[model samples]
Target: MNKLIFLLFFAVTSCTTFSRYSPHNKMESCVEGYYCIVNDSLHLKYETLGGFYFANNLKEYRKIKVKNKPKFKNIIFYGKSNILDTDYYLILNNEIYPKNFYFKETVINNKKITIALNSNTNGTYNKDFILNFRLPK
Candidate 1:
């Protein structure tokens, strides 16, 4: 009976589960201007930007300006290649912003990408946020 109880406790307490979006491995290297986070055993890597550009069409890239320079734009992206259908959040001024912005994925590599938010607003840019990523257990 004691052994059974111990086994049950071990199974319940020793089992570790990772977050839904956790990375497969720990973030070995982070960019100079970036930070990482682990939530529920998931790695979330992100960075903050003052402003960015967006192209209306994916085939043709065009630069559009915005009026209100975002106080800060939080970017959360994947660290691995062949990632599909990943959900990330972009926070601006501590508030969740819309997802109408455009993103450009690098064809040569899957390391990084540029996102343009609020193409209609124009002003000074200020970035203040650490990019975080979740790591798999």
Candidate 2:
């Protein structure tokens, strides 16, 4: 009787957990150096970065790390101008096009990166929305 009850309980819990979060079981795409997930439901991509250097002074670079993991359904393309070690990077968000957003300040706390973007009057980003990004591992 004890064995029967234990098996029933285990089966019920396992079914509930699996039903709550359905698995995609889709294959991931790793072409060239970029990794992507494309299916009928969602699409996301990840690209390795070289660096983001200032055009005026190539000697200095913007210390920014691209998150290697994709958690949302968005098309992200991260790459440098050239394959050279001194290449610079530029991130473009398709949601907010026409106008561009620049990095005002960046804070690293508890292994997480929080980027504060400079206000662009012509941009579509709302002032109330806070942008938080995860660093590359």
Candidate 3:
């Protein structure tokens, strides 16, 4: 009887953590070198430092950790530039979506990294976003 009650409680709590509005499980499931921001029904993930850089979404909001987020930003093809190792410059681009509903470049401060991004998500909803995160030197 005691075991059954414990199991029931565990299951209920587990399901609650996966909810989109769940805040407790937000930082609880992040890996050592990654950070995540929960938006509406999307989980945008960023890495502190790694081989690849950029935040992306390809799955429903969940607490499970994926090895790497997809390549959402391409600074080389879109801007005709090179990406550096110290920082990341990204622009969200898509034509299928209407204006003001896709992705855009948020101003990145040079407190942590020193790179450039020639963002061109103009006339879209990409300019209304901003992300600020600092890594320890």
Candidate number of the best TM-score: 1
Residues 85-106 of candidate 2 have per-residue lDDT tens digits of 2221223222322223333223
Candidate 2 Cα deviation (angstroms), residue 52: 24
lDDT (tens digit, per residue) of candidate 3 on 1-137: 99999999999655421222223222222456444332232233332322223322223211122453322222211111122212223332312222323333333331121123224433222223222333322
**Candidate 1 wrong stretches, greater than 4 Å:** 20-23, 26-31, 35-45, 48-137
What TM-score does candidate 3 get on C-alpha atoms?
0.19
Q: Give the better candidate number (1 or 2) by lDDT.
A: 1
lDDT of 1 by residue, 64-113 (tens): 32342232233322221112211223321223335653333221122332
Clashing residue pairs, candidate 3? 100-125, 104-126
Which candidate, 2 or 3, would have the higher lDDT against the true structure? 3
Deviation of model 3 at 121, angstroms: 24
Question: Each candidate's TM vs. the true structure?
Answer: 0.23, 0.21, 0.19
Consecutive 10-residue window with the lowest summed lDDT within model 1: 54-63
User: Cα deviation of 73 in candidate 3 (Å)?
Assistant: 12
